[model samples]
Target: MTTTQNQDTLERLREDYPGWRIWRSRRGTRPAGWVATSLTPQDGRAPTLHADTAEELELQLKNPPMGIGLDIPGQLEWSGGR
Candidate 1:
C-alpha cells in the first residue's frame, strides 16, 4: 500500500489499542511489517509484537498479547488525545 494508507492503518491500530504504539520497520515503508510497543516504568522491558502485514497486525490487536483477553472490534476511534 501507499505511505498514506500505511499511516492510516497505524493510526487506526493506535486507537483500537490504547497504550500501544505500532509501526513499520526501517527496512522500507509501505506497511510491509509492524512492531507493537508498550511501556511500563516499573515493568523493566516488554516484548514487542511483530506482524508481516497490516491484516496480521489487526488480528493481534483484536486478540491482544499475554492473554489479556481484550475483545476489540474491527474498527475503533481515537476519541481524543495528544
Candidate 2:
C-alpha cells in the first residue's frame, strides 16, 4: 500500500534516486503531481521525468525514456548513479 502521498514512499524514492529530486509536485503554478529532474551537471540538457504516481516515477527513474533530454536553464547538479 505505498500510496504516492506517503512520506516514507517519497523518502525511499529520494534514497533510491539521488541525482534526481523526487517529490510530489506542490509548487507554484504547476499542477500537483509526481516529478523528478536529473540534476547532474550537463549541458542543461538533463532529463526531467514526470508521472502521476510515485511508483511510476520510480520506474521511470530506474529506466529513463529514450531521448529524454531537456535544456535546463542553469547548471543543475545531482548524484543518482545507478
Candidate 3:
C-alpha cells in the first residue's frame, strides 16, 4: 500500500463527509493492498464501502452509493471518464 496515496485519499474522504469516520488498513506484507472504510450511523457493524486501492477508494468517495445517508458537501470533478 502506498502510504502517501492512502493518506491523501483518507483526507479527501474526511473533507467530503463530515461527521463520518474513515480509516485504512494494510492487507499485510503478502498480498499487498490497502482497504479504506467509512463508518456512519447508517452502516451498523460494516463499512459503507470498501476499496482495494487508494485510487479506487478515491473513486468511491467521489461517487458513493445512494441511501447511505451521509451528506456530501459538493460534487467532485471527475477525470478520464472514471
Candidate 4:
C-alpha cells in the first residue's frame, strides 16, 4: 500500500479501537504492504494476524484481536484492452 493509505488506516484504527496499539512493518520495495499487529497493552502477546490488502484489513477490523489498519492506495486496478 502507499503511504497515504497507511495513514488513513492508522487514523481509522485510532478512532475505532482507541486502546489497541498499531504497528506497521513494510517489507520489500515492490508489492509493498503493511503488517498491522494488535497487541495487548499489558502482555503484548502474539498478534492476531497479518493484513496486507484492504479487504483483509477490513475483515480483521470486523473480527479480530485488533482493529483496522492498511497500507497506502488501499486499492487494486487493472487494465485490459486491444
Candidate 5:
C-alpha cells in the first residue's frame, strides 16, 4: 500500500484500542515491527502481538473475535507518535 494509506490504517488502530500501547522505531533504528499490548483479562498480565507490516495488522483488525478492538487509523496515529 501507499505510505499515506499505511499511515491512515495505523491511526485507526490506536483510536480503537486505547488501552493497548503501540511502539515504533526512531531515526537510525531498525524497523522491527509493530507491537500491541494489553493487560490479560484473567490475571492482569501483559499480552502482546507483534505485527511486521500493515497487512498483518489489517488482518487482525478484520477478525474481531480476537478481542482487540483496533481500527487502521488509530494504529497509524500511535505509530506516528514514535
Candidate 6:
C-alpha cells in the first residue's frame, strides 16, 4: 500500500482501539512489520504486539496479549489520567 493508505489504516486502528499507539518498524524504504504499544496498560498485562502486516496486527489485537484487549465496543470514554 501507499504511504497515505498506510497512514489512514493506522489512524483507523488507533480510533478502533483506543489508548494505543500503532506504527511500522523501520527496515528500508518499506517497513518490516507493524508494532502496537498500549498507551494505558492495565494491570501490567498490556503487551506490545508485532505483526507482518496491518491485518495480522489487527487480528492479534482482537485477542490481545494475555486477554488484555482494550477495544470494547460502546465503552465509555475515560477522561481520568492513567
Among these predictions, the greatest lDDT belongs to: 6
The positional error of residue 21 in candidate 5, measured at the CA in angstroms, is 1.1
Off by over 4 Å in 2: 1-5, 27-31, 41-46, 68-82
Which ten contiguous residues of candidate 5 have the minimum total lDDT?
38-47
**How far out, in Å, is residue 77 in model 3?**
43
Give per-residue CA lDDT, model 5, range 32-68, as digits (tens): 5666665443322335666777567545544423434
lDDT of 2 by residue, 32-73 (tens): 678888877362433688888777887888877754455445
Per-residue lDDT value at 44 in model 4: 33
lDDT of 1 by residue, 1-82 (tens): 8788878988988888776677788665333568887643223333466889878977776765563433346655566984
Residues 29-78 of candidate 6 have per-residue lDDT tens digits of: 77679899877666344568889999999997887766355566578567
lDDT of 2 at 18: 89
Candidate 3 structure quality by residue, lDDT tens digits, 1-82: 3567656767876787664566665456443443445455454323555667656755766666565444555755446797
Worst 10 residues of 1 by lDDT: 38-47
Lowest lDDT 10-residue stretch of candidate 6: 65-74
Using TM-score, give the best candidate's number.
Answer: 6
Better of 1 and 2 by lDDT: 2
Per-model TM-score, in order, reads 0.60, 0.60, 0.43, 0.46, 0.45, 0.68
How accurate locally, in lDDT, is each candidate?
0.68, 0.73, 0.58, 0.55, 0.56, 0.81
Put the candidates in lDDT order, highest first.
6, 2, 1, 3, 5, 4
Model 3, residue pairs in steric clash: none
The per-prediction tally of clashing pairs is 0, 5, 0, 3, 18, 0
List residue ranges in candidate 1 displaced over 4 A.
28-31, 40-46, 67-82
